[model samples]
Target: MSNSGHPKDHGRRRGLMLVLSSPSGAGKTTLSKMLLDEFSDVKLSVSATTREPRPNEVNGKDYFFKTQDEFRAMIDRREFLEWAHVFDKYYGTPKADTEARLEDGQDVLFDVDWQGADALHDQMPNDVVSVFILPPSIAALEERLKNRPGSSPDMVARRMEDAKREIMHWRRYDYVIVNDSLDVAYQRLKRILLVERLKRLRQLDLEDLVRGLLGEA
Candidate 1:
């Protein structure tokens, strides 16, 4: 959201804030991991959380673990770009770190729910590119949820119910892809990112470069 420290290069541009959202069992997490693994320029947005860390969850890597009072103080100081209360814990994207990465020309990928995506886009409209993933059909979605490891029948049913509600928000996204095949969907997702990187508005020095070419400067 913050672009104050951007470099002055015609070829280099500001980083993207790519938001991927989907219901459970829709393959959003899989795609997010793929992007991170394949792209060096893309970094997952690490959030600050007011929750006890689970085993092997390192602070400042998995999350910026904070005490409740510290988290509340951050909220009061407007340190977060987007913050949410979920399941009695505070989670937020710290503005400074995100802005620093963007200024360094590194795209930040956000693997968030629709609500989180909406909050991000609302706060930073120009930098956000939102995508919603979908299952091929309701039956397919059900099957995926059922087959998930350690998922009980009740858990699957609850997730299925949540999926229906989540799917309703797909129209709010800039793009939607039905993840019928993981490979095909990944290709499409990659293409979207590549094309978005080439957007004219994002290229900060094009106007000057073009003028120099035409001898108009």
Candidate 2:
């Protein structure tokens, strides 16, 4: 409920899962890369996937590659914060991995869909700051998808349909930025992160900070 300023944040702050969800061509990936490159303490949410690594994909850095049986065992153990089966492969965020980062005061960026965001919010409502990026219009999103090198006409059509579906979940997010201009959108997203980091509840050292303030009085 502490919304305005960092009055009690002279000490360590707990980190959050800053989720950025968008449809195929809506620029979430680009924003994620920019944030990771510019912010020293922010990292990507490297998911555990059952799929084999492609060329140049390194284990642990690119993904935690696991066999199907191993992944199922993890599911039974409840090691994932959120997980889903997509395109015949299981991908999930390990609870230990992301929670470790959060405890160490490093934000983890999640580039997931709306369903994944919902699952994350349900698990850790206070520690999740969700953002949804939107294309200006479906026509614009379709054009962007069509221009992408690997997208076929059918692929673009299917992505457009999916975009419409994804856009419907905008109201569920804490913030919504239209990816009309990359620079503007990034500025807004960056500001949101800066503000959320200072929320009083996230400042884990607030008790010590308050005691120090009283001592000064």
Candidate 3:
């Protein structure tokens, strides 16, 4: 680890893999959008999926839609950083794009579940910072799911059941934010990102600062 308060000069500035995981109605998606909009250096990693796009969802912007066979082919080719089956649809983060972004010293944001977050950390241990969002209560979660205009009663029930399972993995993440209010949750998420961005280990250029302070060339 680099000195906590000092700067370094040897290595290039490192990138961060920020994973935001939450249950279906926990407000992670909303928080992610806020972070993306607020941070100019952060890039959203668009996942590839086998599921059909929803209304107003662009193919490459929202997700890279692929046929099941194409997705499987990528899997066989080892093109994904992490891939998983969710609700019978294949979803994956393409390895090349994420690497390229990191190499350019850009932070990548992932809005995925715990399984995906774990897989990402396994692949890139040093770069990842995982956060889990929580609803204030199960009742609030159920109400949020039910209030979504496009969801049917059965869909809401299914999400609630899945939420319980997802919430069980909360302890695995580095930070947990209980989203009681959108504005408060967004601010908390933003703060986490900003603090992590300044971590000494992530700022490899600190070596120079240390050397300079010691009067070394």
Candidate 4:
């Protein structure tokens, strides 16, 4: 927990988990990166994966890439908040690290898919705020996919097909933003985070503040 207005109350304030989910090429990754860069208090949750790192990915920066056996062992021990196999690769968010950050009052950001978002919400409904990002149109989404490196015609078509199913989960999210413009989408995401952070239930010491205001504490 975190105390927004007072100090010396180390155990009083807690943090929040903000999740942003979108299909490939919808600009969720770009928006998350920009939000992290702008918000000093926000920390990105680096997920653990069984997939090998991409060309520019760093060991601890992009993800904690692990072998299949290692990932499976964690699963056996129930160490993940949520785990899923996507495109034949395994991915999971470590439960301990996320809980620790929240207890310490540092907001955590998750760029995950719908399944993972649902799992987190089930585990921590009050602390989780999910947002779904949509591309302006399927045609625009296809164009973005085509422009990405190593993307083939077949891959683009498959992504477009998958995107339709993913967008159907948009209603499951607390907020939805259409990525027509990166700048506008980023601002909307920022606003969402800012407002969520201010929710009264999230601030553990709010009772004291309220009573003080009324001279009744």
Candidate 5:
């Protein structure tokens, strides 16, 4: 390890795909933002979508907005690592840019739902480190949805229903975080990323380093 105590500081390594999934009102998005702010090497994977951008959403920063025809063309070209039809819209991860980033040793973070997470793992199982975030309780989740800016009663009800289905897939993830306390959950998320980054298989120069240590170099 180098001065930073990170194995990546000492050797070259392929970066990981960190998949974070949760229901709409859960804290996965918040945790993802915290991780990105903390780790300079990690970048968010901007997805391509057919949905209309919400307020304050940017074109490339939030999502690559595409028409239905454009999205279908991309699908035909096999340009997506994974794609899913969600909530009457198409959403996908672009393959080329994400692969390039991984090869350059930059971790990509995915803030997706369970369907997207499943699709990503199916396509790139070895590279994916999946985490599922859960609300502490259903009541808490309802409160969160209701407290959202401009949240209506119908929208909250619909999201609550979706949350129940999403919570059932928690067991599929490598790690599960109950985001009762934002600080505690963020720390756990950071620890997971750090430990995963230090795994032996991710250290590309380990073989040479070990040989030198044993006087074989």
Candidate 6:
């Protein structure tokens, strides 16, 4: 079975890929956590990484940690939906795991940059719904990056420069959220997911569901 496209809806709904991208200081990470915690059916796409696991990180749950050679083999085999090199390490979404979850009717969430989002959408245009989070202003984004714990002034400056470039890709997203307030932006994000789940393309089985109610199915 193909892992990156729509599966048969059958009697149940097919899952969707929710791709959330933002600059470093935006509230996308926090909002994604909220969705996972609040929704029982939503699952985080645990990535495969070539980097060493952190002190408290688990191998499978946090990330599928692998050697560089192993990662490259998967890449060569076309096993990743999207993969990237970052900070000298490789990270990717495993096609098998993601596809299994989707076929089982569970929503999968992706916390990726615009490049990764674009790649995933290209591979699974029908299944993917991309959202770009924005700060109220660049100054606000700078302040956020600077205020982060353990963030040095130099680091914040570099991130601010990167954020400028990131914000330029806002037009590529299917939806955009201006994160003026964390709570409000989160609400908007939730609404977008709710509506997207109800989309006719995603809810392909809804026709029979409605027809059955009318005794015509």
For every candidate, C-alpha RMSD to the true structure in Å: 4.8, 4.5, 5.2, 4.5, 3.4, 5.6
After superposing candidate 6, which stretches have Cα over 4 Å from the reference?
1-11, 207-217
lDDT (CA) for every model shown? 0.90, 0.90, 0.88, 0.88, 0.89, 0.89
Of candidates 6 and 2, the better by lDDT: 2
- Residue-level lDDT tens digits of model 3 in 1-217: 2223333234666778999999998898888877777666788998999999999999878899999999999999999999988899998999888898888888899988888999999998888999999999999999999999899989998999899999999999999999999999987887787788778887776888789999995
Q: Candidate 6, overall lDDT? A: 0.89
lDDT of 4 by residue, 1-217 (tens): 2224322332356778999999999999999889877776689997999998999999777898999999999999999999998898999988888898988888899988898899999988989999999999988999999999999999999998888888989999999999999999998998888778778777788888889999998
**Where does candidate 4 have its weakest 10-residue lDDT segment?**
1-10
TM-score of each: 0.92, 0.92, 0.83, 0.83, 0.86, 0.88
Model 5 C-alpha lDDT per residue in residues 108-200, reported as the tens digit of each score: 999888888888898888889999998999999999999999999999999999999999899999999999999999989988988888888
Error of 4 at 27 (Å): 0.7
Off by over 4 Å in 1: 1-10
* Model 6 residue pairs with clashes: none
Cα lDDT for residue 101, candidate 4 = 90
Candidate 3, which segments miss by more than 4 Å at Cα?
1-12, 50-60, 64-70, 86-89
**1-217, model 6: which lDDT tens digit per residue?**
2223333334676789999999998988999989887777789999999998899999889999999999999999999999999999999999999889988889999998889999999888988999999999988998888889999988998998898888899999999999999999998998887778777776667888899999997
Q: Please list the residue runs of candidate 5 whose C-alpha ends up more than 4 Å from where it truly belongs after superposition.
A: 1-8, 50-61, 65-70, 86-89, 211-217
